[model samples]
Target: MTPSVERVAAAAGAWLDQAQRPMVLGLCGSQGSGKSTLANALKAQLEKDGRRAAILSLDDLYLGRSARAALARGVHPLFATRGVPGTHDAARGIALLDAIRAGQPVILPRFDKARDEPAPQGDEVPGRIDLLIFEGWCVGARAQDDAALACPVNALERDEDPDGIWRGHVNALLAGPYADLFARIDRLALLAAPGFAVVRGWRGQQEDELRARVSRGEAQGTQVMDEAGLDRFVQHYERLTRHILAEMPGCADLVLNLAPDRSLKEKP
Candidate 1:
């Protein structure tokens, strides 16, 4: 395991040690910052130590493509693309957390990014879990101030959402259902990338890996993007990603600062 994985696992292990009931650990990071990687590693470590652990990625909870299309028609065009608040099934996430906490059997949803929708099947946890790692790009994010919403953070916002409707709607969702969902986390950890400037390179690496997986028949999906398409897709996440980086560090229970290359720059 990497140092980040070890560090997070150590923290999560400690959290589980003292918990009176099932615990939820929220892991937040920007796109391609390895939130999923760390969560999987931590889950492995937990199970090795005789704990029942599971991971629920926020990405997998995204509303279906058709749902997002309706959102675009009714709300904003940007909703047609996932990655921001209002794109996920926050109620489902909350219910999963609740069920796990109550020692109930629960089914976990999975999103097939290749097809841009939910997978045909889901992961069913037949029994209660001791720890749940809820990881995502904006898992524990908060809504930005209305004043901050007035300014366009990127070309996507300035040109397409010039009226601020899309971002405003996203912000409202963050302050509402998203807030309630995040509140259930027993502890929150952050994999802090150096800055948003490095996100494209990290995200591009993910796409490259996904493309390779598809070619090898190990994964399914034709949603891979070339440079230009990828750049535009990255724009969909830039605003709130920047916002999370700026604010999450100070408040996150554990913040692991990373270098541009995704290595630890400083210990948590």
Candidate 2:
């Protein structure tokens, strides 16, 4: 683990020490802001301290392509994309958390973004978990008020959702099921990027690395995005990303501000 990750983990461990057993830690951040990386590092650190830890990602609970297609047809066309609220199977997420809290064995699901489908079932945990790290872009995000959703955040909303149908729907999901899921978290952390403008570049860098790995035969049959495609793809998440940026820091238990270059800027 990097020194920064270790520092975050150390503080997180201190917080966990006072919490109840089978604690759920929610790590929220923008796309490519290193939430997953921090979750994994914390999991390792917790294990080193003789605690069994498990990590769960909200991405893995996303509705399958076909389900999202149905939502697109019934709700709004933008629902066809996976990043926004209303695109995840919230019932499944709740069930997984219930099982973990009940001390039952559970198998996490993994989503393959490259193929736009559920990849495979993750490893099964046979007993109660000591710590559960749940990470995602909007993990701890709250619903924006109606007035906040009045103006379109980007071209995607301006052009495709002039009537405010899509954003309104997403906000409802956040106010309901997503809020319930987040309420189960015992502690919450935020990886605050310098600003929303930095997200596109960070995500682009991730795609570049994916493409390089595919070329070296480390990844096969992956659906990598080109620069233009990446830009459009991120637009779907712009509104909520901005909302989290503005709101989550104040509510989260720990906030790690990240610099434009993606390094840890300030400790919590």
Candidate 1, 142: how far from true, in Å? 0.5
lDDT of 2 by residue, 84-198 (tens): 8899988888888878767688998888876889877677888998788889999989999989999999998999999999999999999999999888888888889888999
Span of 10 residues, lowest total lDDT, candidate 1: 259-268
Candidate 1: residue 2 Cα off by (Å): 1.9
Candidate 1 stretches greater than 4 Å from native: 217-221
Global local distance difference test of model 1: 0.90
On the 0 to 100 scale, the lDDT of residue 214 in model 1 is 83
Query: How high is the lDDT of residue 217 in model 1?
Result: 88
Q: Residue 110 of candidate 2: its Cα lDDT?
A: 86
Reference-based TM-score, model 2: 0.95
